[model samples]
Target: MPKKLKLILINSSILLIGIILIELCFGGWFSSSNQLSNLGIIKDAKFEFDVRNLYATKKQSITYTRDKFGLRGISTYNQPEKIKILTVGGSTTDQRYLDDSQTWQEILEKTYRDNGKEMYISNAGVDGQSTYGHLKSTEIWFPKIEKLQPEIILFYIGINDFYRVNSDAKYDDIQQMESGGFVSQIKDKSVLYNAYRKLKGIQKATKFEVGHRKINFSRTPYTQEEIVNEKLLEIYDKKNLTAFKSRVKKLIVYAKSVNATPIFITQPTLTYRIRNGVVYGTEATKYLEEKYAYNGVGYYKLLSKLNDAITEVAGKKYVINLSNEEDWNIMDFYDYYHNTPIGAKKIGEKIYQNLTELGFVK
Candidate 1:
């Protein structure tokens, strides 16, 4: 073959590869954003919004134009003075499956009105968040809530913390968890890393192999019980559980300092009923199966240990154990992590009962 011909062939091949990479990245093959947007779910919007503003510092103002998940547009902070309740949590507290009106925050507000108590509840919940996120929200937005002079602050968390304590993702510290100033600790230098991700997306889209023999698209094979138990133990032994307990204690103290009652609600999980069954699997399952293997007794044992730590720091009065005897079912969850609208309603009711007992309301 002539040298010129060989050179031309090599250049063409490189151009083809570059074109494929660009197509993969932009074609919704490499990321779920495009596909998820089509679903028109609030959770999806929240996730996409967070990703877009991951590195932003200022509050991204969002208007309530429509309900992707049945959320209602109650009076914003512009309304007349009223008793204010600030609720914080991950997806469950966020009520991903429920519309804004169906959320427990709204439910609690309506409940207050029904009983002749006038109050305004602000939903400060975010999806895919953790205890760190809750702490971040309190730090950044507590003042905004304080401007309203909120009488109570409700915190529903735990599941995300349980997952994040073991995952590889380096999210913001508690201080900046809600700030949108996200920066990955992992360096983006590996050509292979970028190429692998791009190629994976292309394979999913075109279903054609350019170089690789086969493409694998399967759920991470692992059980939920294993993942939870592993993460739970990691939090315990690494003293993360202690750190978390301390953070909760500090949050409560801070709330008291501001003259706002702080109430901690232990968010429920889907496996509440099937305590003996597995909860997760897929590629993500390998992390759990390899790290933490716990039986039913072992699982509850870890919970007891963590509960002791929390009890020691938070006292029984401030802590609301909503997971203890809740009527949870598999159908209540969209996945292994989040709860349905009805499930969140039950959780909201439990929280209301706890608030009543704590004298936050009549």
Candidate 2:
């Protein structure tokens, strides 16, 4: 045994012992506190902290909480017999920037309770999740929710589908990418992975964009007869629209299979506007016009087509058509699509109103 080799072995043994002790003493606490353990893994995931934790994003700041199931909003896991309404969607449904009481699901629950009806709502929204993500999540979380035996399963989805199609990504491809492989599994358990996530979080914290304030245009630029790019039609291609519709249909089928009434919503966005017959909109809207050619269609036209597909697949009775609703404006939105707390309240109220009007909820 060379003296140099002995020294190296001794130092390595000491380092390993130190790491083991640190992990044994603090790894659980660190991971649990970081709350990034299951950040991407949504199934049966729980937030690291308890109720009333303040979570601030680029748009707004609000006290956020997660149920024991990791779903946003308060946990009603113990409350059996409450008419459970599981609301699902992308970041809009997530509404993490809104306090638990201000969320539409919470507002709905409170409204029902105030009216002497027992109701519980769980939010199953994930940021950036599209129909592709929803389909997979429903597969994983549907049965778990079935145990709760929810009466109405509300889906506030659509805009993300458009975003996905526009991004030139396929649902199947996204599913595969998100489905962690062997390497991801190993990386997920690494301390370095947690550190990287924390770093990203810090970066996000520093660069938060406030709610989508109104963009003041000096004057109406495009007239009714102005010429616009023809590529806007390509935003909603038949291929992506078919995929979106198919996934939505599958969601409805899955809900019905569990005997849960499924409700589809045509998401509203600031992307729609009519100016002198010119369908001009935000940068994204203009980007579609210049980037892709789709039979000379407009951006809003593509959104309408997607909305129509949702309504066609879900049927009129079960679909909440907010696309044509006049209330959603720049004030209601925090970005191109996600809603402000006010917007969330209006949406929540609308859902409640529609549900009652349709006699889905008594």
Positional deviation of residue 226's Cα in model 1 after best superposition, in angstroms: 8.9
Top-scoring candidate (TM-score): 2
RMSD of 1: 11.8
TM-score of 1: 0.58
TM for candidate 2 is 0.67
All models, RMSD in angstroms: 11.8, 7.4
Q: Which residue pairs does candidate 2 place in steric collision?
A: 223-276, 224-276, 224-277, 231-292, 231-293, 234-294
lDDT (0 to 1) per candidate? 0.51, 0.61
Each prediction's TM-score against the native?
0.58, 0.67
Per-residue accuracy of model 2 over 1-362 as CA lDDT, tens digit each: 99999999999999999877765453433454323333343333433322222222343445566644556656464343353777788777886556666788887777677767777888878765677667756654444443566788888887656545444454245344356686544334445444565475344323322122333333323222222344434435546676677777888987888688999877776655443444545432233313453221244566778888888899899888877776565556655465656777787778778778888776
lDDT (Cα, 0-100) at 86 in candidate 2: 77
